[model samples]
Target chain A: MDIRKLVGGNVARLRKKTGLKQEPFSEAAGISQSYLSQIENGHVNLTLLGVNDLAQALGVPPIELFRELSEMNPD
Target chain B: MDIRKLVGGNVARLRKKTGLKQEPFSEAAGISQSYLSQIENGHVNLTLLGVNDLAQALGVPPIELFRELSEMNPD
Candidate 1:
């Protein structure tokens, strides 16, 4: 449905949880702050590599980013 | 860098490989054709749900979708 919003929300949540600002987070994830902002705003499409970078920067599995989906579905 | 193009290329490749039209594939993936089109065109920001749906519809693991990245990197 609202995939952009969903992804943006997830990215924001993860960033906040990591206690990092946009600049540092982007640097850690090897992405530009503008691009990270676009992702957080759901304005840009993401590749698996970008997702992997974010997951690695967060020290978590990529699946963990989507874990909330199961909570909403519960089926 | 070009995440949208990469994702769109992957989706298009997978869809063509399946010998299915956009409608049937969308239906099987439980998504709207417009939405799938957006994804294929790199115009939509996809969530893990959408990715998983496409993966299931294509009869492949999600990781398989990103396997190409390894080949591109090779390091």
Candidate 2:
């Protein structure tokens, strides 16, 4: 899959795993809801710091945002 | 390590691993040598597309660029 798609899916799943909706999560992540929507839709080409910012909001390491599902679970 | 430093070092080492100098490699990567220099120095914020671009230039998967040394080797 494309990295964009992979990242988007991961973001969506992780956000759901944390028990927060887009509004609350985006606020915690310091991004607007519309922007987070775009991110979750695989439409944004994020800056390196943007990756960090999102990861920080999600409490994951920056690299976790980049890994494939297989690499992430490894099981 | 900081992700910027991690990415910078990976770029430099991968470029070297492929036996290409910055000038030629940057030319092949379609980025200016100065920008490639900044990337190698960990002073730039790359877009997701930029990550894909650099990984393409290095002939590695995009996720490889985000991996640490240990992850790369696993040995």
Candidate 3:
């Protein structure tokens, strides 16, 4: 199902929806900009704590990142 | 808000709901039993890949773990 890519896509989408750049968003999330880029590219895995931090910074629930999974083609 | 505890509690609850011991479940999830125990205790951080793996093993969506956050006393 490539959940990592799905999650990464959603994170990037949500970040863009806020009209904030990776630098400011990563700073607000207490993560490095490079890490954020890796996350957006599905190149890195994240802890549950990281998910919470990013969600808080983005003004959303952590589960919001997975909201689109139902619509994704898991095959 | 102690998100770690909340998440740990949920993971434990879901695991118990299946009536399977940690050993079998951990094996199914491709993690060591000790590591699963730590996760159940909220003492270890998990990567996003870990979350997906656990969810797949548990036959649920990864977001299911966070579903109870709203009802939790965050203070």
Q: Single out the weakest 10-residue window by summed lDDT for candidate 3 chain B.
A: B66-75
Worst 10 residues of 1 chain B by lDDT: B63-72
Best candidate, lDDT: 2
Comparing to the true complex, what docking class would candidate 1 get?
incorrect
The lDDT per prediction is 0.70, 0.87, 0.80
Model 1 Cα lDDT, one tens digit per residue, B1-75:
345555666787789889998999888888899988888887765655557677778886554444345555587
- Backbone Cα, N, C clashes tallied per candidate: 0, 0, 0
Ranking by DockQ: 3, 2, 1
Error of 2 at B48 (Å): 0.5
Global lDDT of model 3: 0.80
Residue A45 shift from truth in candidate 1, angstroms = 15
lDDT digits (tens) for residues A1-75 of candidate 1: 344545566787789888999999988888899988988887755555557677678886554544445565587
**Chain A TM-score of prediction number 1:** 0.77
Report the CAPRI category for model 2: medium
Off by over 4 Å in 1: A1-75, B69-75
CA shift of B38, model 3, Å: 1.5
